[model samples]
Target: MNAADAWKLACGNLSNSESWWEKVIQAYQEPCRHYHNVAFLDRKFKLLDELGTASDMNAVILAIIFQYYEYDPQDRASTNNLAHFQEFASTNDLPQGLRSKVEALLTGNEDDLEKNANGENDVQLLQDLDMSFLGLVSDAFLDIIKLERKEYDFMSDEAYNAMRRKALQTFLLIPNIFLTNVCRDRFEAQARANIEAEVQSLGK
Candidate 1:
């Protein structure tokens, strides 16, 4: 489904305003964004159907829509995306419970991964979906790598390679890169292989 249809489905019975949709589109289309664009959202929306279930499908969709709303290669610590999403939720008069769930998913922290591994399913599904790109077949995975590298074009090769290697290594060190059983079964081995290959390429 397209993002607009997915947004409507997610907003079910809530106020789905054109202005809000326009803002989301604008954010993703920002010039600095390469990987985190409408195409990315469409990919996630497609994958959402394959993921088993979420406690709140609405919140998951919302989280996917807004997760990178405020991305900046220069500001890795920026929380503006979450802040903006909260503001959007409040403005749309969405239920507090739903907003909270979406916030937790968007946070995408290690704690959420732990909860997923411990049997809490919602966050696990969301996180697995986020990392699904890593598990793509070799050619497709390399294509995403090129797009991601464009996002950090400002960085010198040495700096970008060092940072990228560290991030990829962290995934390798994780006992299970994909938290959910389904993802582990489907993508874990290939994801690890892809990351290892990318890390080697970065080193050279």
Candidate 2:
């Protein structure tokens, strides 16, 4: 994966890096190289231009996770989305070393899930719940960004919807949120849809 993709993966796995790693190993057979891509640099500059070096890591993580729902790792992406997440996070004005930690987590989790699932040990279901919660946080920000872009002059609804779709997906992935002011004030409906769909999906 490229730098942008690495950052994206990192953000998607922001909390509970081990979970991200487990899924990543499931997606690809082997690990790839190190180094952030060029676009990552550009992303950082663009973010700094806007947020001026104090960009919210939570919001930024949400944004990257939003991108995660667009592509299916079941395809020929070579590796899982960890690379993509890292790419986006490193280049943008988000936190440093977060991507690295996530990568490490991904590497280590190669056997944890299977062992736990196979009854090798009891599972901390709450930790899994937190991963889902992160996705909900991702989705909440997606709709908010859509609404904000609409407020930005000359932005089209078409583009905004695309963004919203991605956010909704990330939100659906974890399907949980601790609670944020903007989440309740806005994006409540979309969040509900994500939760219901995820629940129904698991039921089936």
Candidate 3:
């Protein structure tokens, strides 16, 4: 479905925050966003359905909400959105347990996959689902990163290639790219291949 539908399903009784949700959705829809858009959120939702903790309703709900928490293009650094999410959660009367988990995930460093992959709970599953999209849509995702560089006017081929290589290298260095067994089986090989190919191409 669309962002509106996703918001309804994920946000539940937080219907009063329609304006906040709209602002978030619009941020993802920003013209500069090529990949981290509503479509990305939809993909994460699909993955959550497929591999998330469906048994725990709270887990599933939290996973869906976390996917969009920092997906907004405006929050490129993801700093502001964390506070926004906590406030939104508090106002919506989310339980302390779930709210704490959300805070942990948001406060954790985005680049520290190992640090974030602390537990096998729904939060970890949510993190996996978020990263899984990058593997699944490797080429397109990389293209989006490149597009973002262009938007900022990278200035030269060297600068752009350096940025691209750094991103690829970081992914390659990750110990376990996919957290779930099913996702790892489905994507590891192809993702590695794509990343390796991109890294190789950077020199050409």
Candidate 4:
């Protein structure tokens, strides 16, 4: 199914007010999002379903739903996206605990995630949910990264290499990319291989 249809399915599953999901859909349609658009969300949900990491259905849905709400596809800034999600949660009277977890995943900070490791299952599931996109088929991963790279082609080779090296560093720093055991088992080696290939390509 397309992004709109998949989003409708997610909204139906969440049982949230139509207006809220509508706002989310509109936010995703914003012009700046080449990679993190509806298709991205759809792939994430599909992975969650396929890998069985969707333990807390509502949180999983919300986590994925609010992922890009404050995103400025052009600038790649998420400050507003994060704020808007919190506002939406508060306005909807969602539990603070649940909202917190969703926010953590949206924040996507390695240090923050490590510190917030109190709820092991929930946190792992959320991590796995987000990382699932990285576990896509090799060509798919390259395609998405290429799409992201298109925006940066004007950069000097040195600058681009710096960005690529930073990406490789990030992959090395993560202890385990996929959090859920099943996903970890399925994609861990593949993730490593993909990183290695990218690192080699960058000659870093």
Candidate 5:
């Protein structure tokens, strides 16, 4: 599904707001964005549909919608996006509990991952969906890397490769890249192979 269609699926009985929807669409359409655009959301929504295991699909979809709301290459922490999402949630009258859950998922810290391993199904599914790209076939994975690199075009090749290598290494260090059982079974080996290959190439 496209971002708009995914939003409708997520909203369900809730009234859809054209202005808010447009704001989200515009944010993803921003010139600097490449990998984190509407197409990324579409992939995530497809994964969510395939997984079909989130306890709170609404919260997962909401997190996907706003996770990179205003992505900035310099802002590795995504603090601005989180703040903007909080405001959006408040203004849209989202239930407090759902809002909090989406915030936690967006943060995606070690604590959140830990919680997901400890039975937080919704968080696990969302996190796994966000990371599903890492497990794509080599050509597809490299295609995403090319787009992601464009997002950081300001960085010199050496600097960007170093940063990319570190990020990929961090994932390799993790025992299991994908949290959910289904994701692990489907993606773990391929994800490791892809990351290892990219890390080696970055070194060259």
Candidate 6:
């Protein structure tokens, strides 16, 4: 499988984020870009303790976070998209409600995964959720932000801005997931503030 496929499926559980995806690639000539992207995220989980709410995550909420990761960040252009998107969905057999959303997203054959799709229904998922998990999630976010394709060498300002804008749109979705009370109170606000600041600083 390719680096993207390996990243989505291998990150079945939170711990899987730390797995060696480079070894699984067919073209294992250099650093598997996708693997390092994820590993960079895995390393970010260390901050959970600072929030004083590190050990709170139940398996599913944690699973939600993990499952959320597996879903492709790319949009669906056709039917086989489900087959492709499934590679990114959580391996744990998603919750019925969440599964319904996945099916809907797939069946509708939409372009990109939107904010409300996963953001709306957040209950005890956060009560059980912890700082470490958020740390990991944020790390994942950072890794994604740092993702630089070998293709995008130093180039024109317009070219760089276009890529940055697309990435910023994706990054904007994370705060929606953290809308739950604990996440909002502890991390979401700070994350948003930081994102905004960074977004403002991008070409300066």
Candidate 2 on 83-135: residue-level lDDT in tens? 66655455554465444433433333324332232232112221221222223
Candidate number with greatest TM-score: 1
TM-score of model 2 vs. true structure:
0.24
Return the TM-score for each candidate structure.
0.90, 0.24, 0.73, 0.75, 0.88, 0.38
Model 3 residue 38 CA deviation (Å) reads: 1.0
RMSD of each: 2.7, 14.8, 4.7, 4.4, 2.8, 9.6
Q: TM-score order of candidates, best first?
A: 1, 5, 4, 3, 6, 2
Best by lDDT: 1
| Candidate 5 lDDT for residue 95 | 80
Tens-digit lDDT track of model 6 for 1-204: 223433454344534344424332322233434433444334333232233342222322233233223222243132253443354345444455555455443344233323333342322332323232332345554554556433244456577766766665576775463644445655665566556655676753
Per-residue lDDT tens digits of candidate 5, residues 17-37?
566788888998999888989
- lDDT, residue 73, candidate 1: 81
Residue 112 of model 4: what lDDT? Answer: 40
Rank order (by lDDT, best first) = 1, 5, 4, 3, 6, 2
Which of the two candidates, 3 or 6, achieves a greater lDDT against the reference?
Answer: 3
Please provide, for model 1 over 57-171, each residue's C-alpha lDDT reduced to its tens digit, 9 standing for 90 to 100.
7878898888887788887796477888888888889888778778887775435322443466667787888899999999999999899999999999899999899999999
- Give me candidate 3's TM-score against the actual structure: 0.73
Those runs of model 5 whose alpha carbons end farther than 4 Å from true positions after fitting are: 12-16, 108-120
lDDT of 4: 0.67
Candidate 6: regions farther than 4 A off: 1-36, 40-81, 84-144, 148-157, 163-177
Runs in model 1 with CA error above 4 Å? 108-118
Model 6 residue 107 lDDT score: 48
Off by over 4 Å in 4: 1-16, 73-78, 95-120, 151-157, 173-175
Q: lDDT for every model?
A: 0.83, 0.38, 0.63, 0.67, 0.81, 0.41
